[model samples]
Target chain A: MTFQVILVLFALFAITRTSRQYRKRKVSLYWFLLWTGLWALVIGIALYPTTADAIARFVGVERGADLALYLAVVLLAYLVFRLFVRQEETERSITQVVRQIAVQHPSKPDETH
Target chain B: MKTIALIPAYNEESRIAASVRDARSFVDGVVVVDDCSVDRTGEVARAAGAIVLRHVINRGQGAALQTATEYALDALNADALVHFDADGQMVAREIPMMLEPILSGEADVVLGSRFLGRATNMPFTRRMANRLARLFTLAISGIALTDTHNGFRALSRKAARELTVTLDRMAHASQILDLVKVRRLRYVERPVTITYSEETLAKSPSSFRAFGIVKDILKDKFFTRI
Candidate 1:
């Protein structure tokens, strides 16, 4: 629960810093939330012998949750990469508009204007 | 000042006429660069008494800007170029204020920021979006601005000639920023009002469209190598 709350705060900070809308923020937040949750879920199953044995028996997997956490984190990172790239592209676009405004005039801002 | 308003319009037939008519009140002349719009955008802009140049097809906003800037710079001999949206969102009076810095030789490029200065009826979602966009641009271009994606802006002839926008779509904004940053262009942001319409709000991008915008930006960035 604490991890989830921290993840939410991190998501907010990330969204506020980026040029995307809150809707985008929400999307990114969920993506991160799922990423963290899946890993946490795997960790809980692995660290706790009782939980690990029960899940392993139920899922009928020979491998334990430690391997699952590692695989999940790697896979989720790749999935999240695309989102990060898109955010960067949007940032690049915002930079372009500001540059045009900056390049054409080449004057010190007077604030009075 | 000998200012030519360069309006890059695409399939904006439904709103171009009003835009041209409203713009005539402030600008000395208007140049409408139609991006190969299949609708009556060219005809309407022309009928509204603007010097309309129609693209053979929808080439995108950057192409329109390049075409119009070339015309305004070479043929029209304009002192400054002001780019406006054909979506009927910007006010005409803002043109004079946008150019004041240029005319006074106080700045090279003046961007009209919707979030800065006085604002009216701006939606919360848009306000947040504009703020984020502004911060992103500031980080990338290393120029602090109050608003980043505000469509209304004016540039002096020198700045206009200095620009080399390569993106053929929304990514054009990003490409322009990178160029300015790399080229070290001087720029500033001015407060301007942007009115939202029910029609426009109704047409806001869907989830698919939002993701598609990302794809388009990436595709253009790769194609232009910007």
Candidate 2:
């Protein structure tokens, strides 16, 4: 999983660099990065022998840590969906506001003759 | 006779030059509000003889028009205001026709209608969407308008000055209908042919987007209504 850790680091680096440009969709992207990092952390932790042994006994599964990771993924998916709805509403309101400005403002004089 | 034509554009550099050239021949003044377009929409329109207002960030069609109308009413001291689209859908000859009702004091506002009678070069899909919107507006406003979202509408300074339009997006058409119904403005629709170009056809909002516009009106009716 060394390759995966490097990939996560690269993603974090890129997101941090371009976060400001994410203005409108920043929150959604932030959540995505957070969830991804969480999964990576969980995976790296589960690879440990002591944690895997403890999880296997706790959940009555051959790999208890895997079950725990699966549950986390499901919960994260639900949370992301809720946040997506909120983002859609925000964008919709922005669209409505912009359209109003278009009709309300008149053009200025551009010619002399 | 002192009127200004308001044209709000975003990335319309290609078509606006021709549109502004057409508008200058008819109106006393032409103002093109560039709503933070990421192009030379301002420079081209200004060079085409239009007063250009640049928004620091992209607002929307309604917001840009709102900016232009306020300037037309306040700074320009216009006697009448024409809400013209930046797209080349309207003709300069129809400006006089739209002006007649307001100029003659027959109506406070005049709407130029393409569906009311014979029109030229109208695409089927765009026509369908407009007709659907017209029907919805008719039901909501209880006004039998054939062209609910006609971009060639004109209003006297008094009427235009009084409207407090707040919708900043495409929902401004519904906002107009609601205001007309609420304020009881002396509004009339006149037949005017609108020409549709390939660019305009491409810009038509998708059916999904149209549904979003309808939902926006409903949201306002529930959340922001009196």
lDDT of each: 0.70, 0.76
Q: Tally clashes: model 2.
A: 41
Q: Is the docking of candidate 2 incorrect, acceptable, medium or high quality?
A: incorrect
**What value does the lDDT take at residue B164 in candidate 1?**
68
Give the per-residue lDDT of model 2 (tens digit) for B105-222: 9988898888785778776776788788878888877888878777788989888876756666788877877887788889999888777666776785665588888987876776
Measured by TM-score, how close is model 2 to the native structure? 0.67
Residue A110's lDDT in candidate 1: 25
Cα displacement (angstroms), candidate 2, residue A14, comes to 31
For model 2, give the interface RMSD.
Answer: 6.1
User: lDDT tens digits, residues A1-113, model 1?
Assistant: 57646655665555444425434564566666565565556455534647665666567665555546556689889777766667656645654554343224321112113
lDDT of 1 by residue, B1-226 (tens): 7998988888789999989888878887788877768888877787786777666545567767777787778777899889888888888888899999999998878888876767667777777666666666676567667765666889898888888665556656655665656766677788888777887666544333434445665565453343
